[model samples]
Target chain A: MTATSFHFGEGDRTLYGVYHAPSVRRRRPLAVLLLNPFGEEAIRSYRVQKIIAERLAALGAAVLRFDYYGAGDSAGECVETSIDGMQTDILTAHEELIDLSNIRRVAWCGLGLAVPVALSAFSSANVNLAKFLGWDPVISGSEYIDDLTASHAKYLADALDMPERRIRRELSMQLTEVMGFGVSESLISDVVDLELNGSDLDVCDDVALIGRKSSGAFRKLHGQLTSTASSVSIEFDESVTWNSHQALNSIIVPNDSIAAIVRALADGDE
Target chain B: MNERIVQFGDDGRLSGVWNTQRKNSNRPTILLTNAGIIHRIGAHRLNVKLARRLADIGFDSLRFDLSGLGESAPAAGALGYERQSAQDISAAADFLEENGRSDSVIGIGMCSGADNFQRAALADHRLSGLVLLDPHAFPALGAAIENMINRYLDPYRWARKFSELKLNAKTLSLRTVRSKSEFSEYGGDTDEQGRLRPPKAEFGNELRTLTKRGVEIGIFYTAYVQREITRATQFFQTFSDYQLEGKVTVNVNPRVTHTYTTLQSQNMLLTEIETWLKQRFTD
Candidate 1:
């Protein structure tokens, strides 16, 4: 695969992305956009996401994995990241991919927290995508925020060998940071209000939810998506946890989940 | 400032982002690599922050991944990881020089990348300076004694020690063996403790040669994790006979982790690096 890394968008809104062109040309080209989770989750899942992009590109699908503004190598700080801004970034990335590849048959593969980002973008924009893949998707933004905050507290407790209760108390006094990245009040306010229903998956013609565990939320969303979407599938293969203190500073390339995602995205790529 | 993607290496496979001043400057280009397998963005996107900040000061930087990591393609040849890393660092320097940028390069690395940077500096004279973060350190008796005393004095350490007592026999044995090894590169020469390292005398000789060649070195150690070096002075103490004080700068920060996970740690590290670069490189 031939990979090209560059900054897209304009001025302070510029975003960074790596576009991987397929090794071999196909009659009908397919494009996949990989959306990342915020903050430390993005860092932890960077390798796995890269691996997925490489694999998907190898299968004759052009892949574009990008950092939203205020995240990754993008033009803003983590504290400046907002859910609304991320939604706009996705739309901008989609336009760039389509304009570059001239392939409108594009699919989005949202990993971890990005699932909600993708859903929000689809609802706010006129994005009638070919397929949507949510791997270890976050169904509730509030839960994700709480989980990350707890992970941050636990990480500090473990690293400093402090009492967990004491760490929790200190963290509660100031909930401005999560796992080392600063959070903006506006971003927090927007994310906390986000709770995705099965209707959120209505933006795509086809949808696939792949995760390590099965939950009532997943079951209900799957059933709901099955009726509204032309085709929908769900798979579970435990390998890695997306957000946890134990997984911090550890590289996890989930081979099983990657394979399932590849199969889902490349289903009709013949 | 301008940032653009660069692919320069064998078969045009190595990937990097070049952050440059809008107008050219005479400052030496900074070369950054992956901290272990964390990719070119560094832990907490520290590389991006550092590169942009350095650009504000008119210094150019290239934050790239070693082959087979991040966006860079894997090497097809049979060269080992360390040898391949050295070659990759040289290639980054070459990219700068060939593009009319300054030939002098300063490498900033942490953990495994620091080890790779030091090795690369030894082989490539183009590297004029190095910022080694949490780099290698041979065990020193004084540092151990100091660390033990500090640990005992900290009331929090008492709680940790009690918890550590609950560790399984296997985990305790593993720690004992690791404690003996001190430090070594991965998949390299090994001994009973672990990877084999040249005797301290030989390592000191290499440092002397680099200093004689006018390579300005900045060595930093962090105690956020269970590191081999517990104190800042331990690095100089490890090679006290070499007389490296005037030629190199050494700092040990107990507040920062190897990865610089917290915003406070990142700020402290970036500030130290900028201050070091200005002091050592200013014409």
Candidate 2:
């Protein structure tokens, strides 16, 4: 396998990343782009992403993993890494993959919000994404904010000897004062507007894999997507567990799973 | 094996160990919080490795238990999310500060300890950084399942009985909620089919507060199923805007679960965190 570092220009800031190419130098059929999660989870899961790139290379597919402008070994600050910047990063990486690897077809695997960014980016760029894999696509950003709030409320109520409703109300007002951006308003409106049925994307023959152990609510959302999008394939893989005991903490993705993905991408060649 | 009781509130005493490399070394402190049902010993091996690693980088570390689990005093009623654990963390921070080890406090926690870091960072301004191993953003599978069973078996009678039990529990001690109706209303309930779910509309309001408080947050997420990481990243990005200076960074380990224990995986994680902390703290 060949691993090399490169940089791409995005206006003033230069986005940095590493490309993993298969050892066998035959022309590749597809290029795989890796999108990571945010915050502490990202720190813990760094190696697994590298392993994925290497495994994909062994399978004869070109793989690429890059840091957003503000994260990893890249330039910029955390505050400057916005949703728009991340989307742009994905688009830039996609172009680099095509140009460097000379691969006409591409597949995207996004860890978290990367999926949405990829979906949104590919659609906007008019890139003919041959395959897509989203690991628990966030249907609504606002709802996720709600989940964070509920967790805090639950803890406060249990700890402070206060009523849960009272804590919830107090926490809400306090959060509003703190967030200043009116996250509650944004979250509420976003949740109401979110549609995960792939209605926002033009890509056909896309597959969404939802972990059975993450949340039943997410599984239900996948079901909704399957029904709404004709070309979208939804599969519930039992190996993926987010919060449950079945979730293996040692490494998020197992070798078998990586092999399975490699097989799937290779099988697509036929 | 080396354990000492560090008292926090009147009745709360945390069982933990303080590993000091040497005198006058000015080492940064690492505070570890244990996972649910797992005692301090369960985390000992991992904590030891972490402590040694941190010490090598010029830092001291402490691993402790919250109020209920391990050797700490048990809560009178349901511990739930261990919200009080934040207080315990504050007390730990105070201990570190008193010993001159609080200048750069980096908290490394699992599950509830991870949650406590989020809460503690809000209260304690002394913390320089936090590392959450495999935190669950939502309730655990067992809790959700129990909630589902309670709702499915009997709605009215169960609610009534729960309320009565809660009232007694609250009256007898410094319990949070006094009645079942109040508890269900606050905790949320399952439908007839028994699926424990969160009311996103209401919960979003609370997260807005946590994010706005400017706590540096990092996540090591293992996406088992498809789109798990995507959903999590979206949540963080949306909320990160409220973070202190808008600093939020995440790395997804593709096939690895929440914890990085494998020799190869752990080394990669350590190197990344070391690099991140060095840059973040120095800058």
Chain B TM-score, all predictions listed: 0.89, 0.63
**Best model number under TM-score:** 1
DockQ of 1: 0.55
lDDT of 2 by residue, A50-126 (tens): 66677777778888887776554455533354566677888888888888788878888876556666676776676
Query: Compared with the true structure, what per-residue lDDT tens digits does model 2 show for residues B53-161?
Result: 6656655667666775544565555645445777777777777777666465778776556666856776677665777655443333443454466457755545555
Candidate 1 per-residue lDDT over residues A1-270, each given as its tens digit: 677888898667989998988767542378999999889889888877888888888888888999988777778888988888888899999999898777899999998778988888888888769989887777777887787778877776766556668867876777777876889888887888878777777776678877554566667667776676375666674656645544545666556777878888998432
For candidate 2 chain B, the 10 contiguous residues with the lowest summed lDDT are B189-198
Which regions of candidate 2 fall more than 4 Å away from where they truly are? A5-7, A25-27, A150-171, A174-193, A206-208, A213-221, A224-234, A237-249, A252-260, A268-270, B1-283
Off by over 4 Å in 1: A23-29, A214-233, A242-252, A268-270, B22-24, B153-155, B166-168, B175-199, B224-227
TM-score, chain A, candidate 1? 0.92
* Interface Cα root-mean-square deviation for all models: 2.2, 17.3
Share of native C-alpha contacts between chains A and B (below 8 angstroms) recovered by candidate 1: 0.52
- Residues forming the 10-long window of minimal summed lDDT in candidate 1 chain A: A241-250
Candidate maximizing DockQ: 1
